[model samples]
Target chain A: MLSGKKRGLQSIEFLQAPIISSSASVAGPLESKSSWAEDFDWIMEDYLLGESSWERTETKVLQQVIQIALDKQQLSFEDIEVFLAGDLLDQIISSNYTARELKTPFLGLYGACSTMAEAILIGAMLVEGGFFTRLVAAAGSHHYTAERQFRFPTEQGVQPAPYSQWTATAAGALVLEAQGNGPRVSSITIGRIVDMNQKDANNLGAAMAPAAADTIHRHFLDLNRDSDYYDLVVTGDLGLVGQDLLEELFVQQGVVPKPNISDCGVLLYDGIPEVNAGGSGCGCSACMLCGPLLKKMYRGDLQRLLFVATGALMSPTSTNQGESIPGIAHAVAIEI
Target chain B: MTPDSNEERKKIEEQEYQQLVEQVRPRPNILLNCIWAFIIGGLICTLGQLILDYFRAQGMSMEDAGAMTAVSMIFLGALLTGLGWYDELGKKAGAGSIIPITGFANAIVASAMEYKREGYIFGVGARIFSIAGPTLLFGFVAAVIIGLVKYLTMLW
Candidate 1:
């Protein structure tokens, strides 16, 4: 089991199990009143955060969040060897601009809302492979920026369909070191693109649900574990609608993940009806994992967690071109 | 389960999954939305008529009063859009708010306000007509064809 080879179909067992030293989560004002607000490190008073543009505020949040994590452990930029960060922007602008400020060796990733998990899994692999002793995995998203980029402008008067998700204006950063005293990255399942020709952008949960189910199913298959293996299996940004679809998928596959299975998107809102379906974007799960979930782990309330971040990989251009939305989900298992 | 080896089976499976999704997904109540649209839209039209009547009572000609009512309605729509209330209205009113001339004004002002940050020339100027452009294009085409038919009928 400790062999440095691929374990199953699409999973990798990190022999070294890179440790998470410290983490920080920051969200916009919209999330300040959320159920888990107290768990967050900080919440901005406004989406702009006094910046002229939403993009700038997103970059500032990403940069400041990484610093916040490092500050918690008395670490500095010189202590980090690599930075893996991403955002939901045209070119991952927030991460790129933040990287330029930090001047750290960087890798910019784009997995849409799955960015946080994608970055974490890759960072864990690199640390276990002895590539670097220290790396930072971070991701963030802004509601306003995502609005103009994906849908219409923030102020544009288009009524959101009942199935539409509220893109979270949030970010999270975690410090991953080869050795530390915290939860360890035990294993990961890299997802595949699962597209059922679902073309409705307003219903991202539907488009992304299949990919989440596929990744989660394969994770269990590779680990040869039951639904009760992990203390909890939480999917990223699969709001209420996606959660229901996933339930059906589980029933079909003879998997009863009830009571243990949950969704970050649905939990983030905590019955905030105006959010339509629920919270989404990369930050939806990032903050959940870095904030409340991690606190639960530290408190020994949880022993094992499977964080499967789902993403609908479709751009406005692709939608206009009549292409279906393809979805992907990456799973990272953390054990304390 | 492993990826199905049979292509036909995979297609059928995908279809089944979508069907399952449909069963679970929530739908907007069509009847409720229609009712709200009817009420809100009717109120907006009634407001316009009230304005026309007020102008006509001032001894203004019928044509002048009608033109003033159109201007007043557009002004109100644009102001509401700027104040961000029009969109809130739009959420409930749906096609009821959209079928009138005020809806046309809302469409244009909304685009301009949204694109203001991108700049004047390329942003507001180029994109101002984005939402209402199609309506104007179709209106012109229909008008030209109808006028041509009327002229030919008169000659006949």
Candidate 2:
């Protein structure tokens, strides 16, 4: 019971659960127009963030999110035991550079788009194991920065494929404490790398959908729970195509997950036109969870929910070398 | 681990990985992409022709009109990129955007704008050609090759 492991699935049931004490999220212009716009603590009028490059802007976002989260809790960076953060950039410079400025004990993660959830899962585990009392989990991604790294330069006038999702420019950070009045991290299901040989870098949704389904299925078997146990089940950024595929795969596997399943990618740009497929990137789900979803939990709107953050773990080098895209997903159950 | 074992393991993993990928990913819709590119690229070339015609009607020689049209089109492309409209077009046009001369201009200005924060000299001036540098380099190289061929044929 003290040990977090369950069955043979390597799942963690946080015996000494940690509370999601407080959180803050900041978004760029396009994300600010999403349904969760009002939930964001701050939204930049421009993507610049007063910096020259989108990479620098993303770093500024992570820095601001950490500071804002700390401020809301009436604490400082010194109060947190560790800062877990990452982003989609070369060498994860966005999080690396931001951590340097924050001056906190940092553990840089690179789960691609799943960095936020991975950070939170690890942060919650550490806190619940009595290793630390307070920790911060954060991640960020900028559309321009990501585009330049994974595809062509934004100004290169290269066209994206139809299934391509717009990389969301946003940053989200959460403060997890050993005990608090906020939501609790009940359990976590870490996913395996499920590469379905999707070679197209533009269509990340297809590459990542299988990973999401695999993780969700594993979470159910490990916990020995049915779909009705949770109010809603959501994926990171499956977009329109991935969402459809996820539903089809779940049915094929005879795993009828709660029908309320939705993707942050599909929701981030609901009415925003021209954002083909939908929103994808580390920020897509991170911003949604930290902003709107957390607000709903605070208002007693949702008692239990599953947040399965997915990531396409392919690099420019791998894709160019004709390697198929590998995808991973990590799920965490949160309850108020 | 031994080198032989490591290499063998890597090969097996790669093979298995490919098999897994085949199960999940759907086939790409290339027909749709071709249609979009065809329409957008045709429209851009048509616009260029109209610009050239207008300049020609204004009493300019055909050569002068063509040159002026190219200049104006390049200017329009750069301006559109600055206003962030070119990228919107790019999302739909795919190769269509890259095939046009305007797309070339868009590439230069876009890089310049992105690096503007680094300052005028190092950011804007230095990195301005990062995207278009190869295009210019090879374009001149090909022109020289073609010119050399024509001269050689005449001599023969």
- Using lDDT as the measure, the top candidate is 1
iRMS for all predictions?
Answer: 1.6, 3.8
Q: How far is candidate 1 from the true structure (C-alpha RMSD, Å)?
A: 2.4
List DockQ for all candidates. 0.59, 0.34
True lDDT of residue B65, candidate 1: 100
Q: What lDDT score is found at residue A81 in candidate 1? A: 96
What lDDT does model 2 reach?
A: 0.85
All-Cα superposition RMSD per candidate:
2.4, 4.4
Candidate 2 lDDT at A222 equals: 87
Clashing pairs in 1: none
lDDT per model vs. reference: 0.88, 0.85
Local error of candidate 1 at residue A179 (angstroms): 1.1
Q: What is the lDDT of residue B72 in candidate 2?
A: 93
